[model samples]
Target chain A: MRAVVWIAEGSWQACVDQARAILPPDTAVTLLHVAPGDVEALAEGARRGLFGRHPPPPPPHGSIREISDAEAGRLLATARERLGRECETMARRGRVEREVIAACAQADADVLVLARDGERKLGPPSLGHHPRFVVDHAPCTVVLAWAQAPPAVETIPPPPRHRP
Target chain B: MSEVVALLALALALAASVARVRFAPDWAVAVAGALVLLAVGAIGLTGVGHALTRFGPTVGFLAALLVLGDGCRRAGLFDALASVMASFSHGSARRLLAIVFAVAAATTAVLSLDATVVLLTPIVFATASRLQLGSRAPMYACTHLANTASLLLPVSNLTNLLAFQAARLPFARFAALMALPWLTGLAIEWLVLRLAFRAELDVAAPQDAQADADAERRPLPRFALALLALTLAGFVASSTLGVAPVWVAVIAAAAITIGVRPRPAELVAAAQPAFLAFVLALAVIVAAAGAHGLSSAVDALLPHGDGLLALLAVAGVAAALANLANNLPATLIILPLVSASGPGPVLAMLVGVNIGPNLTYVGSLATLLWRRIVHAHDETVDIAEFTRLGALTVLPALVACTAAVWLATQVT
Candidate 1:
């Protein structure tokens, strides 16, 4: 079975652990991390806004793009090490939700695994915007893992009472 | 009647495009609005030509400063300075905040607020993140100081440039008058931010071996630093030399371009034709509006005299207008009304527009740009939190700054 595990910065471990626990040992796993393109946009925006139409000289350490790529590589590397298995690691950039969905489709995976990346509450917001979109649109069976233990039932607010 | 309605519609459209709409760039929207006004005969072709003529020096000055700032950024001057500031903090988050305040203020005063926002903010973010200091306080420092610190020099902000041109104050005289208000506003901003972000600043800055090593390794760009210093000196000397400040800036920009030897395309990008075009178009629209009953409407509301109360009234109205529209347009509309009231009210309005943007995201272009930079770094400063901080700072700063300017006027 082919499975794609969506890895993100804070909750990648949960997704990796859940994928490892449920997927068959022989399953073809691909680890996917989507780095948001805001950093590159920031660099470009600064260039066009501050510098005239020309590219500024190279920064002393590295360009923001280079630095951001290095960071994504580091995050993916850590996620891979925790998964503790041979898998294809892919890093894509742009909108997080679209990239995750596209990765799953391109891999032709039978299942998609991802963890909740937003408020660990007991409602719709728990999935956050990106995960919510991915859940609704993914083409395959989806496994939603919690980054941490789910909140207790008491944490949910009581229903609104209408006056008689 | 139709002309007035058309002009009002164009104003609302420009505001929405700048503050909310994202499809087309602000310059495009502004140019479109200018064209609509022309087509409606609200303004003639000569009016457009007049705006280009009147604003040519201001636009050229802005473009020149952008190039100069970019050259410094390319040469690693800001990054090197940020690294040094980080090192001087010696692993104390509080000290780092102080250093950021000082450096950001100096950078804003010399290079302009846009420089502080675009170049210094990212470096400050990276530095804070590296030192494990938590980027919130220092990043806020960079953005806040970008606005407040801009009050010191005519070149520090586009608003200041507009006011300086209208008032015809000598460069040194302008600096002398603004120095107290600038210092007062910055002090208030520093204190309020320190209190508001105390949680972020109270933490110990853990020493990161790699960060320390990185900071030590980056070499300072002395040539760029010298160029910047010389440019500031040139600004001060321009008035005495019987030259407009724009010439000094243009010459300095040319010198830096030669020194950097960037590609031609890079030079064009640095000039930012779209932004210059936006300024010119906006000027035309404002000029047309002023001609068609807007000025009399504004003049009726504007307070007269240089008394403290009058100055405060002018500043309060200006701050409100800036928040309602954007500061650039606010400056364009307000300056023509207040220039006749003398330097005191003119500088008071400058203080308001400069410091007032701290109150909201749409109040100034720099604040909006700062928000994007913060978001790009994976940090969020929501509207509520931003307003809370701005409320805590802008009022106190505005009052004290206006009072300072009033006092300067009285003493002189």
Candidate 2:
């Protein structure tokens, strides 16, 4: 079996654990992370903010793209550790949903795994619009991982009114 | 026939400028529209020159402000401030949120809305990410406060500056009149944001992690803070001395440039020529629109009277127009009509344009820029979700601020 696992900015340990348990030992996996294509937008915005009616010159060193590249690399590396030896990693640049669908098609994977809401968890099983877009458009079996639930009450520490 | 063609060009240019599909940069679309207007003889060179003469100073002021803001950002001033604010959270998400609000409000009030959007958004995002807090609350706060907190002074937003000059109010007088509205709008925005994000704020984040990381990488530069204080003092002093605010901004930026000696490339990046083109093009388009029909339509719709109710009506109409065509262009279209409506109506319209943009992404360039910044950080805020939040916050803010402005008018 071949799998394309989409790793975003939040916890996807559930998806990784499930992939581990379910995939055959020889399963081929592709780990994909899509950085948004809004870097130019940000640069323009920064320009507008900094210079009201001035033209923006070429960006400086340490552009957001560079930072996002490092972030994507870290995310892919962490995902690879979770998926183990059968995985190859890719970090593409574009809209999250479009890139995920394209990645799955490129890999010709039978299954796609992604977190429903990559970050913000509001105590429900609702998915982010991007993940839902992938689920609707992707040409593969899709797995939606819920955010990791909090510790059980018995294991949790008593709530304090304020931080120490 | 040329009129019809010019109108088509205008519509196409406006759509292309803000469209999701990027055929060219936004500035290119705007410039193309302006050129088309000239090509079609819809506006003569004299008309273009006239528009430029009237609108040019505001653009120059914005550029100067950007130079100064970019200098501060390059100096690590924004980052240091973010670190300090985050440190106070001390692991509590609610406290962190409060700090974000306070910082965003103060930054917007003092430096201008774009300054808050440009300098604070990324730093706040990093702070949230580093602390294991979801980026939603802090991110939203940056955009929301950029608009809501911007009514404190004429310099706080481009719309305010336009109205300030039109109303011919002195700087201190403008601030005194707006202080109440600014406070009320901010209070309403805070209440709405807090209620909307209650669940998100309840999450326990790893506190002080960002502060530790930030401290090691770039310790707070005390000189940056000193420069900022000195720059602010220049603003007040120049206002009292009856000097053009732009001179103060330019002088302060030059001083910082001398002391900081940032790279030429850094300065250029901050200048953002494309945006300047967008502003210039938008002005020409509005002028064309005015010449063609938009002005007559607005004049008809513009409420007439000096009563508080009349001012509210004018504000209501301005806010609606702002959400439809954007605040900057809306201000341009409405400025001439409102100038005759007395300072109360003009200030009320300012309130509308400033606070009303929170309702939609396209309501202001600043909001659009905020959206881009958020997306660049790899976080997504759904349009529906954003609107719901905006609707809850903006209406109350508009009402409260407009009422306050009316009260100020009565007093003054």
Candidate 3:
């Protein structure tokens, strides 16, 4: 079965690497990372309580590639290091959802494995917008790779009762 | 004592209906019932003149655009566009999405908001399927962005109409300023959605050059175009010529019914559940206006001037409230209050609240229309989702816009 994996910010490709290690040797895998519009968003994501920053790659082959900053190139290379002989990388230009869906159509891939951390629940997945949109919209069967067990819920103090 | 009892009953009824919606999980039925009650309230109890005045322009514009939009839809304009989009399939999803957002924004800047929803939903649906993609992703982006784009131009949306009429703004000035914020908001909204869907976008196939015959072409009759033009004329006449909007819309709808020979069922299908919400908003806001008197009273208090903070606060409050309430009636309820303030405040409030609807599905007619259409994809957009995602997307943009306008007041 041909499988296409979506690459996201944070540890998406890392999780894909983990999945690649686990998949049958014969199953062909394609890794997809749709770049953010401006590299600055990814670069500045850390302070906003999010992680994973990579500069955009030079435009993909046969596609437009505007020059991005040095940081974007470094991050793209760092993320691209994971693809093995069994997998190929397609660094997409533009928004995430459209890229993934378009790639799925082009590849005619039989299965779509969406690799992400913290979404590996057995029940309905709490996918972020892109994944959720993919789950909601993508045509081929999708297998999402989230965390095996959800992070343990932490208890918080209850609020004080208002004195009316 | 009587006032307290009435208030209690009102609160209880609202509470019960909300609880029922949660319990039954029957959103459509719940909304339908609410719309019925609201419509009855508007037609029977609320003065016809007040309801008509608030929605008159919107109804007129929608009616006109409906004819034009329907004609375009029949003419296969969207389908042809989809064919063009499909031709670019060899490109990355990112490029495709950029095209969609850009087109959606531009089309909505000229076409009405609801028209954008009605027209784009099917094309995106068809395009996604044609592309071997099926997700609520396209639906959400198209719907949300369509509404966002509609607020950019005066000719594009009802909210802009309110601002245009109130500010006495020439179309050129309206476009010059709001256009920047409009693009900014769309880019921000798209970026947020793109971030949400980053992984799903990676795909590779050489998009084919063969145009799907159905996607590229549709047979639209000349009579249909004429009818559409006539309806459009009626809509324009209502707004620009000082005729009643409802009468104009009703006449156009009647003429279409008489002329097109489209299925009566199709007309009802075309006239959607969202219309009920829109009409309900008209009723509820009119009633709410009588009860609260907060915004109007506040506008009465403030002297419209170069007071930057005051203008920003008012604009911010109007935006929040516009999302809190729907934008149409929100615009209506606030119009008088804004007028009382001044031209500068009027323009600011219009831009802020009109665009503000994109923050939540309940915020505008187009978003609400999207809620209905997105359902067909089997993924739903809820109020809570909007509140959460909107914080990252809608709220920040709203802040940026208000700040932009407040700054503009100094120079303009």
Considering every candidate listed, which one attains the maximal lDDT?
1
Superposed by TM-score, candidate 2 places the C-alpha of residue B248 at a distance from the truth, in angstroms, of 1.2
Q: Tell me which residue pairs clash in candidate 1.
A: A51-B270, A52-B269, A52-B270, A52-B271, A53-B268, A53-B269, A53-B270, A54-B266, A54-B269
Q: Which sections of candidate 1 miss by over 4 Å?
A: A1-164, B5-9, B12-16, B19-23, B210-216, B362-381
Reference A-B contact fraction recovered by candidate 3? 0.00
Better of 2 and 3 by lDDT: 2
List DockQ for all candidates: 0.05, 0.12, 0.03
Interface RMSD of each: 7.8, 6.1, 18.5
TM-score of each candidate? Answer: 0.72, 0.73, 0.55
Better of 1 and 3 by lDDT: 1
Which 10 successive residues of model 1 chain B have the least lDDT summed? B377-386
Which stretches of model 3 miss by more than 4 angstroms?
Answer: A1-164, B1-58, B133-137, B166-173, B206-288, B291-307, B361-388, B406-412
- The global C-alpha lDDT for each of the candidates, from Candidate 1 onward, is 0.77, 0.72, 0.53
Where is model 1 chain A poorest over a 10-residue stretch in terms of lDDT? A45-54
List, residue by residue over A1-164, the lDDT tens digit for candidate 2. Answer: 89987766544556676677777788798888776554333434433432224333322324445656665686577668867776788888766688889889999999998765533534332555577688899999997775566436576556878977
Order of candidates by TM-score, top first?
A: 2, 1, 3
Could you give candidate 3's per-residue lDDT for residues B136-248 as a string of tens digits? 34555666665566656666776676667566555555666676667667777888878765544543222331234234544445555565467546544554666644455
Instruction: Identify the CAPRI category of the predicted complex in candidate 2.
Output: incorrect
Best by DockQ: 2
Give candidate 2's error at residue B344 in angstroms: 1.8
Evaluate residue A69 in candidate 1 and report its C-alpha lDDT on the 0 to 100 scale: 64
Interface Cα RMSD of candidate 1: 7.8
